[model samples]
Target: MEWFKVVAFVVCVLPTAHCASDAIVWCYHLPSCNDKTWPTISPQYCNGSRQSPINIVSASATPNNNLTKFTFVKYDDTSAMTSIENTGDTVKVTFKSGVKISGGDLSEQYDSLQFHLHWGNGSSVPGSEHTVDGKRYPMELHIVNSKSSYNGNTSLAVKDSTGLAALGFFIEVREAAHEMI
Candidate 1:
């Protein structure tokens, strides 16, 4: 069987988490810090408001007609990505200063921070983090942003519930074939 690529520009806006980390050792696959031990390993994230893997009840959703197109600042310059690093989890890219986003139902303009890609080895059932109809893509990109009001102060930004925004993009790798007749 050949690989099927996923290509979708899914923009879901919601109150999400902050990009704050500490000395506490936690991970996605490690036995000590996996889901089974998350409560004991990171009690703060296991609390009432931070629970993940939530089910979205589309039946109860209300359309927001006020959502306007996003305004991107300094993105056309092509120098937005300042640097890149591999954090053992994924490939991270730090966006250049001044690149920002506004409108699109966002309360305030969000300054571009960094983005990363999460991928899984070619697996049959489980492939990527973003899924549709139980089908997973090959890779997912997360563009992290903080409210411009924070002024690059990560510590302060992490305090507010709506301080951060993550733009998720799903990418799929397709297999092309050429054969001799």
Candidate 2:
């Protein structure tokens, strides 16, 4: 609900349609509704037992040998670029056709919908969603996917458990940027 307000503010306040990252910062770090004040937004955010971006405690994690290794289908295949747009909140890349992900705790294959980036202004502070042992990353990449069980109906799939999945990666700053960037 509050995100919509930020979107409107960017559209009205900025001369151009584009929204600077600084404006987005204010929305996320809102004094009344933030990570610390998540309960104010919704009970699900803080009060609920199920939550995301949780700290992964390695010591308590148990590895399962039966888990299969992850595999991607048609991932390297060359395809025509669909569209790339800056949606004020995030820069997103869309593809005409999606790649299928199989294995690694997934009983059913999932197809990629889109990929988005979360980053800060290149500061020492981190801006990623998830943290490891309470340590955050400066940037994060999330490849969203929906299970084949959905039959291509993302809207319906989202409401069901195990209908969606997201592959996340930490982006560490380096001396040279990747060619893909």
Candidate 3:
């Protein structure tokens, strides 16, 4: 009975294993791994069904009139842009009043809240979701905002991934700069 069971298990598994094909693998490019510089690594798997990268070759690619544009207006209050300082793994930023970002499909005017930087431990890696030309930037800034424009309202835009929009700035910090936090 034991011999029959083993034979049955193998018979059922062997064909399925043979019929399975490889899968497209995705990986993040980080600045460092295990406190050391991140090494160039290839994807773990490759298969024929993998999707190809799209490149718009048409020169006529233009913005449609129906498309909403998000306008980032520079407020005269320099204080809104200040107060950004790196603290270990995180960077904090504060915005002053009269600073507003509008346009696009925004249902309400967004007011700046505490923003932070998310990045890998090294220079080579970028800690963000979207990559440019498969290359990672050194750091990514997440300028968090609130749609309600009021504090202690329990309306954190960051809490809802689909409900909020984030302005991501990919930066390469090569030198130190004085800023507020």
Q: Which ten residues in a row have the lowest lDDT in candidate 2?
A: 4-13
RMSD of 3: 19.7
* Candidate 2 residue runs with Cα over 4 Å from true position: 1-27, 44-47, 175-181
Quote the lDDT for 160 in model 1: 72
Q: Write candidate 3's Cα lDDT for 25-127 as tens digits.
A: 2334434332122122222222212111112223644554654766555555665665777754577887765466666555667665556765676645545
Clash-forming residue pairs, model 2: none
TM-score (all chains, Cα) for each model: 0.74, 0.72, 0.46
Better of 1 and 3 by lDDT: 1
lDDT: worst 10-residue window of model 1: 12-21
Q: Which structure among the candidates has the greatest lDDT? A: 1
Candidate 1 whole-model C-alpha lDDT, 0 to 1: 0.67
- For all predictions, the C-alpha RMSD in Å is 4.2, 11.7, 19.7
TM-score of 1: 0.74
Q: Which candidate should be chosen as best, given TM-score against the real structure?
A: 1
Residue pairs in steric clash, candidate 3? 30-125, 31-125, 83-180, 83-181, 84-180
Give the whole-model CA lDDT for all candidates, comma-separated.
0.67, 0.58, 0.44
The TM-score, computed over Cα atoms with residue i paired to residue i, of candidate 2 is 0.72
- Residue 167, model 2: lDDT of 75
Q: Rank the candidates by lDDT, best first.
A: 1, 2, 3
